[model samples]
Target: MAAVSRWPENVVVFLYAVFFFHTFSSAQRDPGYTFMHQATTAPIVSYYDYIIVGGGTAGCPLAATLSQNSSVLLLERGGSPYGNTNITDLAAFGVALSDLSPTSPAQRFVSEDGVVSARARVLGGGSCLNAGFYSRAGHDYVRLAGWDARLVNESYQWVEKVVAFQPQMKQWQSAVRDGLVEAGIRPYNGFTYDHMYGTKVGGTIFDQNGHRHTAADLLQYANPSGLTVLLHAPVHQILFNNQEGSKPKAHGVIFMDANGLSHRAYLNRGPNNEVIVSSGALGSPQLLMFSGIGPKEQLDAHNIPVLLDQPLVGLGMSDNPMNAVFVPSPQPVEVSLIEVVGITHNGTYIEAASGENFASGTRTRDYGMFSPRIGQLSTLPPKQRTQEAIDKAVEDMQALPQSAFLGGFILEKIMGPVSTGHLELTSRSPNDNPLVTFNYFKEPEDLQRCVDGMKIIENVIESNSFSSFRFHYLSIVTLLNMTASSPINLLPKHANASRSLEQFCKDTVMTIWHFHGGCVVGRVVDHDYKVMGIDSLRVIDGSTFRNSPGTNPQASVMMLGRYMGVKMLRQRST
Candidate 1:
């Protein structure tokens, strides 16, 4: 035995040395380096503890959060990851990525048959491609819409933590801030946890590491365990059992993968199994109706066989319509995000005390914060203090310092009059995308408010402050449709003379991508985020927001997804 050991000693040492060297070399190499392998076979049906539909703004977060402890199946209709410099960093440069052509696949769909839908369809969903603004909505809007302060506040905190939403390091630009100040519209950091009205001035811009923030950062950073993020998997219809009851209980979902192949999966419901819908406003409702959970009349028309008589499923589609009246910048606005955040807290607190000035009645809500007043405005008498506050806010915003270049602006016209829109199934073929119409400016007051908002912007641009900047107006072709031109063109036009004041004001209607209230809380899902009238089903996203919050909705949606994930986990624990 001693003689044999001596002979093998050198051989063992050599093998061990070679193994260590290979392992060390492998670890030192680039992590992303891999032999590219083409996906040859289409993936067949797979089961999971949780199934989340949509890969957009809300869905991505939901999947990332839920899959933290358990397996999650995230399905997106768009292609694989295609990261661009602008899409990953600058918030202002995201929309422009669409022009990259050939590389930026069309994740959006066409509604009204001919009209294109601006919703994202890829893996990171809309977050991968949204204007990386992390604006929080006013608390009042959440409470008014039946959500308690506890839930809303928790949601806010959850989102801020997950996304690490830092305010702009520097002020957006003194010109825009000063212009608002000139308008008597005190700039209030709109993301403040309180008031959305009153005599305030200035606000914060959301950014990430000196660049514009996106959900991709959060999801990738979190790195949920046992989660499969499969892009190009568009859900066609939810499979439900008719005999279950009035509201059909969803059995599972059917989707189309990247190769246009059909696949299906089933959910067991409760305990380990749960299904969630975070498919944004348009996609969520369409999924419901196709699965037999919408207005009876509409469902029957499309031969979807009603599962739940949810008239409100797709009836309350809402979006912020803006008349972005670009004013000439003395110089191109080139402030970095780090510089922007540095000023947000300073700006928010500086004007916090003025929030109460816009209060009406008991002043139960924060006045200085950006509140969603349009929902309540219609109820206020034309002479009431609430209406007065809106008017004053609009007036002040118009007169803001460098009002034309204040980074971004919000006015009454953008809130809009509440109007109904349809999300009807385009064909019995559930694989196709549903039809959507925003029906902007449905009410006479809405049109009038737009005119007023535009007039204010026009007045601000023509003001003495904008004298040094070059300007142009939106093209006639762009005005007729929101999807006609990329959002890239949104800032080009500064001169009112380029288009008649009436044309610029009347024709220009743009979306802030703040769609909400389609699958509202009460009508579609319970406050617990569970789908009403269905078992083992839930909705957690902007689509579940019963009403439009008073500001950017990304924070709120992310919060809701987190809340739902935590609650579901806790319930399972018991």
Candidate 2:
């Protein structure tokens, strides 16, 4: 077990929040978000010992760790996430989207299979948008990845010491815990970061003030002299030297600035100098495909030069298929985020959040997702309320009647889904979203797992632990177990299924946004995470993951960055 930091909890809530804001705004002092230099300001050419693509959840930590001893260039396509309440404050759900930055962090996309999902386009990546749940990857994951166990523990400790915190459990979350236990998940493993089968209160990245501490916050540990972070710099292509009788070597990358100006950054002349792609699952594969490293047939279709015919580059794509139900609370539920999780043995995970709004934890009754509340608006002065936002709010209010106000969400997502799909490039543009389809519940086992999970959820809703929160209908008999009138039923009466339970799972299928794969180990990359058939190139993000590890992948992804960095530094010394 890792030595869990006994760092004083009360001190961190305000200390880190204030520290991050003060240190980040100076814009030139640290290798932090405030030190964000626009790509246009960069020279037409530059050199670094390491060029890291994607300053995301894993990228940020990886680059920060590498910068301890080597000159590193970190490039992010999106802008900073410093002052955005929509992204930062846990209680404030989707208030409004600002034109504050030229690029917004949430890049919305619709997959080929007609499922709507959004990829993070900001510096902290999905960590800025996730539920902030933190749990270690399972023991099986460590053995399978062939990671050094002692170093893995140390890596997790390093990140936890800086970012992860024990959450102050809230009302809705507490009830969820009891309900999970009531449903017979297992013995409670209270207040733990270790992944275990049973109800457990895991660490959270959100502080007591409801402020989010993301993977980007880990940059505080970076060496300022050795790191240069560029924002709004999307890579166009990875420049490679493909000489005959040698493996293709990644030399540099071409990236576009916010001004749409192109710039080049190259790896310096050193045997160990490398270009690492830490872009998320989707972005990493897409970038490789853009740089002529995918299937030969797909490259020919786009007229791209084939650097490597790595057919497995964009294969084995899977998403933990998620299904959720809105539990309408008769009384106003206090705004709460995910603090409790149930690790069931049947390959299913149950977690939940409460709020008045569409974002994680909100409490409200009468507006669309973007509807601007007068009270919330009044908190800010007149100038802070942009005309665009008011107009958007008006538009939302007009569309408000069609939308339903949610009390809270209790969700179940299958872990390590057996049903898989693939990702294909949509166009040649690096920024264009590729076509991805998870084919949710396509396999019989997957469908059966979801159905079984839903049954557990139904048990949770009816359990004695949730009696206070449960809505009692004195007038009509509440038929929770009946197929005809289940409170958890989201599907129409006539949807195709052997029963309404399976139909409910099918109709309400959604993405928890835990999509991983495309560049999996043993297939696209080797055991060491170095890309096969290529030199001086490696992928260290969720793209290489065969599955989203633990309750959430953020902790493991961040840990992998630090762990690999330590390993590489040791290798260099030897």
Candidate 3:
């Protein structure tokens, strides 16, 4: 009685033509606003002098600057990067990061020590899955986050006058800006976005025909009759009230939509109504440790209900540790991604990205500019990691030879390492995915500053103005043999090849995903980004970054959502 197998009629007609073009396609677009669909039951406006929660990249410029005089809302849990084309096609950036589907505006995840990323479930979060490099936010990170260096340069020119640009530098990003001034990384300041120190040329959100431009196109400065947004919704918590202990405010949120129902909204009672969040840095500390706020014994070991012990809600996480050096090129260049940046006064930040015409059934040919040791060799389980140690590291990275010009370079150390990491709560399900660690190189001076940023990318590939490309420095100790049982001496006939290049930087370190501190600012938000003991709440993106600003944090997270929407419209007009 257990024999009903079937399927192969051309795999059931290619699974009914992929469920009839994803159930009769043509829907998702509309970022125009007044948008709805949390499976529409209408009613929803219970209040909202401001709400916001994650339309992403700092909730679409802080809900289009608090909808120009209050009444906002926003919401957004994916769906609507206005006409997706794998997010408006900038060479379909590896088909929007290898589309893991669930409506893919790049949401993959993975972590518990197996580090795989891809965050941004649409609505321009991580500027719709990053690489649209833009700089600024390093005047010692605005005098160590005391900000207001003239309103952070007027919120970096109001998000660089609608999603920045100025790139056009081809030929392998002008040989990585003349190999970072032939690796001396000196004064070639040029086209600045001002993080200064050396070879520049920043700002880019793709335009000039490459086409990206997100942060939901800054909701074209909202106020569409005081914004509303909604989309697939999803919030699921943060509706606090707490009386017996005083302080707990954040009066409303619950969420769920896209036909999962549940709604709620709230906020407009007064005293400057609030709720911000801008979900990022692993979703604003996993939605503030799933609303009860964190570390009260990891939110009572995930049984949840704490309300606010706030042990630094998801602690000081930090990322930016990259180290790639691929270089294939034999001809076909163009098709790029970050343009000319080298910043290094000994804290390394060099960058380069051009993967030449890669749109053939994308996974961008298993795009590996570091960070994919199959999530660190699938963190040990899987029958104790056999399968011939993952097919001899994928046959030694597919025995090299396959290139129609493949140049890629990323060497980010992004400032002296102080190493910090944390973010917990494995479950209490706001749709799970939480435990991220980034304890990368657990501070041995962050593996000698990522082996001094891989000897400044081996001195920009032994420059001579990058001698007409043609390259090959695979080496992460021959691409991860990791200097066979390293008991010292690691090549250059050892005289301490910097302790075998710090054990080949602990087997090729990763994450240049520039993740900032988890709800940080003076540790869980304060310096005007609110959230500390939670009242009207706040968090305006890059998880209120009190640290990672050495560079590429999506133009300092859209200048912290336009400097917290001009300091919440000057504290709601006083």
Candidate 4:
């Protein structure tokens, strides 16, 4: 709307050419990977049959699937996951999450409730950052979502054939499985991708060689010539055509490249041509608000013009609260993420991971980036505090070990967390994380479920199969027990005195990162994931799910992209 600043084309080309080629070495194996380019090279104006913003977990598969029949454009804010050892190598898993540097593949954000979490910033999205556990949504979740069952299964098969794998059962995982069954969690279901209430071995995205296969790998199925993926392209807003007598329609989108230069991409004028937002649960809602499609009051406060005054745009958010006990192993345990899991009938899930550098990856001092022109801020922090304070904080952070180290095992994670919260934009910038709170255990029912789950974990920890790995000597028992203060402190001495357990649940609540909703179905979007009262637009990511799909959602999420892409293609043909 104002004077447009432009970079000289030659300088733009030269700057990006140097940064682009050298960064994508790890991704060179994928044939379609060559199609990726820095957003700076994107044309000033372009048209596509579909413009999918956020080249993330769901976005990648959706783009690849749709490109088979239509021209598709995928815009991602982060660069390729390639050459990032923290993302690709399974052993180096937590490195990016703890890096916290501006260039890290996973960006850290703290909730208002004080739980620190990471948002995926690489092209493969959370798959590039997570523990790589893969499991399908339970039959109940599928039935509740009102999806076509056959199609959903087919979609799962489609994604699993490429990215999902049967992980080799390692020593630590096998013991955990035995302990869960010994604790009476369920009948052993052996290896399965289906979500069933039992101790079962699920799928993983990591191969035998420990190389992670993220959703980006699904691009191999794409019609390469028809798909254009631009990295370092963050969308600014969704452009709309507000015809006097018609509903507000998403027509195009404006995105900024690496240089912050704006480029516009529009949909081909067809009823079916659409713009999809697959920018995760938090990002999708934030994007909608930034694009002027959320609560009127909030938009007004942010000085953003409202095109559609949807009241529930960022409502009904929930992140499954995960509680864990670090059990130190006397012998070296095999390094593993979640390979074995116990799915309880009471709606809580149990899983474990061992041998990660829980202290986070060790980093060199020249990691972080900052601002205010402090003469080339090399080791600066993102906050505005003094350099001394940040240096101390970084030193403490590097020293901190959130989980057990030296081959210790973590009996971790509980799912559901029916407790909900909401997201509201702090500023109009899409890059800024919105104010969010999971409101963990706010509901009485949610608190009860957590108590029930913790009791199960107590049984598992006390079981014979698990005892061999734990320290038994009373001299050091208190230190090695689930809590340093008391062994099985989550349980009440008097059976019905549950208040202490409930308090413990509140005090130590953390996220398993299975958060979903915000642009929830029936509230923000319809059954088809079309945003209420909006046309030629849809929000199709974890944000639309009323519940987290399975033990882990990446598999279900990737499946959703393929499922919906095929459905849309069918709709177009009809």
Candidate 5:
């Protein structure tokens, strides 16, 4: 027989007991109101008072509010974010964005103009994937959009209570804050959720422990008995009842379950029973076009029946163009994102974030615009541009030795781009991604604004406070010279420096992912968010914004959702 173990008998017994409890107690408790993935055995009912497509940043909150007195079915294409460490942990931020898996929360797509971007496919929408920065929509923006000022304020409070937090600024973010003030963006407003002109620290969704509190957390307000959230439920089509000489009514939706099983949920016969499409900027427009609600000519070409000849459904798309100057630091800095923001007087917004070395093994995705694969200046198929950019990025990374620590100071010019883009159907299939042409810098003024923004960033980096950081400015001129659009002068002293800057803008400008205005309030939807020429359907997401809010949009999007939900509730009551 083997010699008797000398370990304490009580310890051995305790370990065995713990192992047994762990194995059995791991079974999740039914929260009753909690989410259910497609693989689950719970049957989706055939009808509900309201069916919300896309359980995203807007949809989650909207669904919860609507469910207060109505039976609501919230359908989401992606799975829940509960246990996804890639999304919940701030340290894994890049990992979540870079994930190319089919079930990744971030869905990677290439625009028609060859720009690569990833849209949120998971619940909580972009909130699950973004840098977790939060800011209110500008008061001017609220007024311009025709939103009720009082209601919008209340909506912000509703959301802030659940997800917003005041961030404790660390070494790097603190330095950036002082630098922005020194660079002339002054009268530091301190920490606030209000979007104001000047340097200020905004709210963040990340807690002090670096845990992300997503918009999904707002679902806690949901009426458990009235709400049913189905994950992995991709809504393919909005079931409509078209009658002769009458408006097309959205009665239900056809979505696929986790097992690829088809399911349909229809609205109750009540007059107020309706369907709301809160699918995000790209998704809401794509779904509208798919449901034959876009340009008549484009829909005809795709051989789809037109429900509403709404030419503006997928048009007027725009995104904030971002040009980043990377400053490599000699020592490791604390990881942060969008803590201190500088709202420049010159229609620009300068923000700084600290990140790990881009060349580090942990960062698998090629994120920078000048990345060799995606940044190469070549006349290639539009679809190949993103791949090429990635490849070029990889090549550049291969040349750099992995550093122990790298700090990044990013500049984002959030304003003054009048140029707009559009989204069109590449195919009639719902699974086929849309052709998104951001048409960035199509206007000369837009390019000039970007150049001015870049100059401001250079000044901030050269400021006395930031000098101790030992910064090495990555020159846009040198990068442009290497690209196909090379042989251009970007030096400040050059006579045609503006022109060179324009060329550089064309070569290197990429999206900061602040996309908006595909479905304008006045054109596509009314002040109440009701879709024009259609009954019982509304679009209540970023796509409905009349213009970009000149700040991070998560807070605005959530506020809109809450505002719309309250409006609908009051209407139903009356």
Candidate 6:
């Protein structure tokens, strides 16, 4: 009996050795899955080579890449993605989307001062809960930012390989494809092989083995050597070196744990190492202001002591407005994962991966941007309400040129013409969440764009592809009446539409939560992603985008994060 007990003890020692040795081992082989089993706790005050804040879309990749050559500590504000009830399950995600209250980590960030904020709190940040759409921005948009076209294009390509984005080819089945074609929806052939602009094709897929690919999956491929992922570590403020004569340096960060305990991690494992803030659009800006890095007047109004007066830290706010037209399936199409998978396999066709082409040319469409037709509407003021304004908006959307083969297309405008919103400090208590007033649709022109977007949806429904389906023309009035003062409601006056399309157009508006702009790049941070007024403090996330890509912002965010990571690694080596 004594001998048997000794064998058990020896086995335990062997396992321990395996973990200890591999923890510091070379990057050639797989690291035992022991790191994945780490318990959620506040990070210890150990010195790390790099300390990345936020484990969301960009932060996850950033941490993973940096850790390849150095010790990295990633801090996240939410719990692990493993057992989160609201995240792992697909139906649960849909339920989360429909819920009025902000319960999911991503939804919770949208509120400020007891209101819903757009930032997310989770191990994977926005990627954990966002609609898994892997698409890129137009080349023109990148060139417009004064970026070398070749460099920007190369960056796009490099990141695409890192993520290994594979669209759902099976979703493009015969039945769905034939139905779309017969209904006059021209297929966008070679979308994955060439320039995606003007290519009318089916939606791309972002899942593997029927499971959605979140940031966690992307990080897994990065194979970080000495990276530690810390969940439930919400960053409240950035600690800056405020000595009068020295350069303003980012030394550490103040964070609160799930149980509300205070913790801090110095950059470079000291009071002088760099701090990378990948907290995202809503998150990074709020943190900057709290750390005294924004407009002086704005910070003072919120009672936040001034640390730096970088006026553009959170000023260039932007997001796409979404107004969805829900049309029930003609037949009871199963809404399960299996059914979605079956549809893909039998519907349209697609490539397994785009190889080199994945990095070049815009090859997709996001149901977010309010098609190019509604340009200049963002210049309107917030309160100048009028029906003529709405009418003009509708006309602009209707003018979007559609191929003769495709009857019409839906114009989902996420970035409205009116851009009005500001970031304000909600509390000086580092423990309290920052106050964010995204002010969605505060401008009348924004509301007008919503109305126009809906009109476009109505036109798309009129196409033959949907004609045979159980579809109905939702008059603008009916739409408003059905959902007024509701986050889901795009139009409010539709309740009063007198059966006339013209009458319906006079009222109704909606919003699509494709948020962007705050802490916008170029204006907020230097070209290398360092915060303008602070040394050794960099922000690489969606907030650093030069402009809201006229499509989904996920791909853009990921690319930017990857680029920043490469830049940081190069600088550190020097």
Task: Judging by lDDT against the true structure, name the best candidate.
Answer: 4
| Residue 267 displacement (Å), model 6 | 2.6
Give the runs in model 6 whose Cα sits over 4 Å from its true position. 1-44, 83-86, 96-104, 109-118, 147-195, 199-205, 269-273, 301-303, 334-411, 415-418, 429-433, 439-452, 471-511
True-vs-predicted CA distance for residue 243, candidate 3, Å: 15
- Candidate 2, which ten residues in sequence have the lowest lDDT sum? 474-483
Backbone clashes in model 4, listed as residue pairs:
none
Assess candidate 1 and give its lDDT: 0.51
Instruction: Please give, for residues 233-264, the per-residue lDDT of candidate 3 as tens digits.
Output: 76878887889868889988888876676778
lDDT (C-alpha) at residue 46 in model 4: 99
**lDDT of every predicted structure (CA atoms):** 0.51, 0.76, 0.69, 0.77, 0.75, 0.52
Query: Which is the better candidate, 3 or 6, if ranked by lDDT?
Result: 3
Report the number of the highest-TM-score candidate.
Answer: 5
Per residue, candidate 1 scores C-alpha lDDT tens digits across 1-574 of 5765777778878877988865443212222312111122335676778888876666766766776677777776665443343344342232332232423533344334122235655555566545444555665566665655676677566556545453442323334444444544444343343334422222222333433344443465334455666665667788766673364566678877556677887774455577788777777887887778888988888777766787878866666554443223334344332111111211111111111112222322221112222211111222232435545644544454542332222232344235556676677553455677666666555565555554444433344443444233533233322211223233234444433433433334444456666787777778777788887788777777644554445666666666567667666677
In terms of lDDT, the poorest run of 10 residues in model 6 is 351-360
Taking the tens digit of each residue's C-alpha lDDT, what string does model 6 give over 1-574? 5765667787978877988764443222223433342223645455577778888878876777777677777887665565443444333333333223423554434332122224566666666555454566656667765555665566567556644344443321223333434433344343341223322222222334223445654577455457877766777788877788877887777777666677777766443357898877777887788888888988898777888887877765655544333333334322222111101111111111100010012322111122111111221222222335434654544553322112111234534335546566666653345545555555656555555445444444454544543336655344334323223323344343323322232222222345665776678887777787678888888777644663456666666666667766776777
Model 2 lDDT, residue 504, Cα:
60
Give candidate 4 misplaced runs (Cα > 4 Å): 1-32, 356-404, 407-412, 474-497
Q: What clash count goes with each model?
A: 44, 6, 3, 0, 12, 42
lDDT of 3 at 85: 58
Global CA lDDT computed for model 3: 0.69
Instruction: Give candidate 1 regions above 4 Å deviation.
Output: 1-43, 80-82, 91-117, 162-172, 187-195, 198-212, 220-223, 242-247, 269-272, 335-413, 428-433, 455-504
Q: Candidate 1 or 4, higher lDDT?
A: 4
Could you tell me how far off, in angstroms, the CA of residue 377 lies in candidate 4 after the best superposition? 28
Residue 503 lDDT, candidate 1, scale 0-100: 44
